[model samples]
Target: MSTLLSAIRSLIFVIVLIVTVIPWALGVLLLSVFRRGDPIYWACANWLKIAIWSARWICGVRWRIQGMDNLPTAADRRAGVILLSKHQSTWETFAYPALLSHPLAYVFKRELLYVPFFGWAMARMDMIHIDRGRRAEAWTKVLTQGKRLGAQGNWVIMFPEGTRIPRGQVGEYKTGGTRLAIETGLPVVPIAATAARCWPRKSFLLRPGVVDISIGRPIRPEGREPAEMMAEVKAWIEAEMRRLDPDGYGPPPSGVAGSVEGGTASGPAQPDPLQALSQPPSRP
Candidate 1:
């Protein structure tokens, strides 16, 4: 009976989300055509703020962000960086773009380009799209796009895990984001979030809860290999996640024996890339 009630409530919430977003999307569309003060950007961002507030008001969900000090406060406004994050829910997908002042270019799968209103907006926003099957070709394309975004002083956000991990466990990191940092000599900032508790992937239900977001210190790739940087960043994020989501929505990888803060376990386990592809999908 309780499950049924939750489902019914979730249905209503979906209605609310659509009702609120559609009109704003239309406004964005018109504003986009004119290429004005980014009506699309402002409208969508304000909508997200409302959405975040609604999640709290209607669904009892709230957000807590920590380690804000980890964010760069320097005068490097033109500095380009690779913002890497743990993928947990769709909330961050919207929240990051709205929350950050710097314009970001996302390296997402080509499929997203087909999404209706959202896809159309992304296209206008100058996001980088890649076909997953064509790994080499994708990398080349990414390099071309990333260089320009960097040179132009825009940030690029990448989910090293590649997709949402419902269980909140950190999958092995994809090397691409790290490689970009190395190749471009840009700093990498790690953002970890637990939005699945509030907005689970693949589900319409939005639970009332406090979501935690933590940004770790940015890593400068100075002379480091991409693989080396990837391993370290992955470890830091997974450890922080385990601390945040203890219910085991996603259990820590078996290969990672020690707690993240205490440093890697003394065991001989080496980091493996395949773990990322094998991670379970979390509901949005």
Candidate 2:
């Protein structure tokens, strides 16, 4: 596709987003007052679906996924997952609510709550948005809400890297997500995605390509240290990243790992790419 066409499609996506989201946000806010629980979340999710669909219909960007069977299903009622994913672009955040069978609560910077229609709509949901500056209070909020949400069957997702990194570059993985998992006794599921293949971080230029999503098996948080466990998550994610999007890492080796599980195991292992959990997804 020509750069001119790419820019045109991107513009169409942005216009559709602005036009569609305003009404959806208003509707969600009104419904939040009259209704409660999953209905509101679903209502909000519906808008996300429309936005994502518009991107595909207009921009020609596409995606693919593997190992979804590894994730817990809705039938496993009351089971909460702590998804630690790689953060590459805004695409994953928009896509996850549509992809997962369950409700997802993100640990995001509090500033997102101010994003007008989109932000106001999210404010009505049960997500935890915190002040990144106040690390102590912020984490306290995460642990408290994370445990509560986990007990209630909501998956709390946290990006260990804290922010988006350029495609192929590894960022510092924080132990916060692992700490939340350990504190709540939830399993950390590492996800590897290639969102930047289509949507670059903080850029409006949406390209056409398939973003691969690789879901690693869950890591049980019992009897583990946060940093140690996160290192394992990091390794599995980074390794799988090389598998899913090898170009970013130069070339593939003669071999690859058999499985993509980043479980919480005891003792020494290669350090986990853990957040770099900023690895987001798409499967079209």
Candidate 3:
């Protein structure tokens, strides 16, 4: 699409997001005074669904999932797991709740709770917000909340790569998610999402495309070292990225990276930014 058209659509999406978020947040805030539990989550989730739907219709962004069974279900009854995913763009952050059946308790940086109406609404959700400047305190907060939330069957989602990398680029994966898993004795489900296919990092321009989400089987934290577990998580996600979109990650010989199964190309047969990244680095 032309730059002019892309910008116009992005503008429309922004307007839609703003309009959707404002009233929903206000409602959530008011409802918090009386209603709690499922009502609050659904109210917020409805806006997220609308946000995700708008992206599909207005910005031409869609998604594919290869491993839905890997995620926790409502029947699990709070047998919460930690989700460690690859971070590449902002799309996955909004899409995850809409995609999953169980409510997710995201472990995010505290700054996001201040993002005007949207942030204000997020602050009311049963999520963990940490102060990065205080590493010790942050770790403590994660451990406490992660354990409690997981036991409640709420999956704690974190991007091991603390920040979003440009499409096809790899970032340093951290062990925080793995550490939480180890501490909480919950399993870790690794997800590889290619959200950047339609949405680019640090840009409003979106191209029409499908996002591919590949979920790896859960990794049990029993007697697992945080570093080793994280290494495995990073390896799987990156390897999956290469498999899903060999042309974007390091191009191996035609039969090499592209040969890996389940790594469907992002954006279907078409293309755009975050070409192969599976998920967005939340709150960054």
The predictions' CA RMSDs to the true structure, in order, are 7.7, 5.3, 6.2
- Which segments of candidate 3 are over 4 A away from where they belong? 252-284
lDDT of 2 by residue, 110-208 (tens): 899999999999999999999989989998999999988999999899888989989988999999999988888898898888899899999988998
Query: Which should have the higher lDDT, number 2 or number 3?
Result: 2
TM-score of each: 0.81, 0.90, 0.87
Ranking of predictions according to lDDT? 2, 3, 1
The superposed Cα distance between candidate 3 and the true structure at residue 112, in angstroms, equals 0.8
- Model 1 segments beyond 4 Å from truth? 1-5, 36-40, 73-76, 249-284
Each model's number of backbone clashes?
A: 10, 21, 11
C-alpha lDDT of residue 100 in model 1: 62
Superposition TM-score, candidate 2 onto the true structure: 0.90
Candidate 2 ranges with C-alpha deviation above 4 Å: 252-284
Please give, for residues 190-228, the per-residue lDDT of candidate 3 as tens digits: 888777767888777888888888877778888889897
- Candidate-wise lDDT, in order: 0.70, 0.81, 0.77
Candidate 1: tens digits of C-alpha lDDT, residues 153-268: 67888999888887545476889998998788888887778888878877767776777776766788787888877888777677667766767545555555322222222332
Query: Model 1 compared with the native: what TM-score?
Result: 0.81
